[model samples]
Target: MIISILVLEGPYNHEASDSAYNFIQAALAKGHAIRGIFFYDDGVYNVTRLMDPPQDDRHISRRWSELGATGIDMVVCIAAAKRRGITNEVLAPNIRISGLGQLASMIHESDRIVTFGD
Candidate 1:
């Protein structure tokens, strides 16, 4: 099935982001296609390229990038990202800065839309 994912929380501070990541990975492993991942609210932090967590911790941004490398679009809500100080200049490779319209389009095009976080 073709799927789209929405993430609404920042990494580490909550489990939502990690859960979303795990779910996406599992879906991909099962040979499902991901239409994209939309980062909304605090989830925009997942696309920030400058993130540097302790070595012991999973690098959340990198994890997203790896998924992006496989051709899944990683979209960050421009308004939400700007409110949190994430600019296009610092976006990770394969991450795109876009408006909510992109999210809407993804939802319209995907076979299923799954959201993680409150």
Candidate 2:
């Protein structure tokens, strides 16, 4: 099965991004395909590659990075990200900065749009 996810909550507060993260990891472990991960609302924090949490906590940033290394496309809502300050690196292509057009595009091109929101 092909699974795509939309995270509307953020990793800073609770593990709202956890569902998507765990889901994606499990899907890959089971040999399923991950279409992509779309971040919305506070979820845009997931794309801020500059995050640095204390050593006592889970390195949320690295976990997401690992997903990227594994080739699962991760996208953040452009408008939402701009408001919260998440952006794309000039060098990262797949992690491009995008908007609802891209979100709609993902929706149009995917099998599911599972959202994790408050």
The number of the candidate with the highest TM-score is 1
Off by over 4 Å in 2: 89-94
Q: What is the lDDT of residue 2 in candidate 1?
A: 95
Pairs in clash, predicted candidate 1 = none
| Candidate 2: Cα lDDT at 2 | 72
lDDT of 1 at 116: 96
lDDT of 2 at 27: 72
The 0-to-1 C-alpha lDDT of every candidate, in the order given, reads 0.92, 0.74
Which tens-of-lDDT digit does each residue in 1-118 have in candidate 1?
Answer: 9999999999888899999999998998999999999999999988788989999989999999988998889999999998999998888888889999999999999999999987
In model 1, what lDDT does residue 61 have? 91
Query: Residue 81 error for model 2, in Å?
Result: 1.1
Per-residue error (Å), model 1, residue 104: 1.0
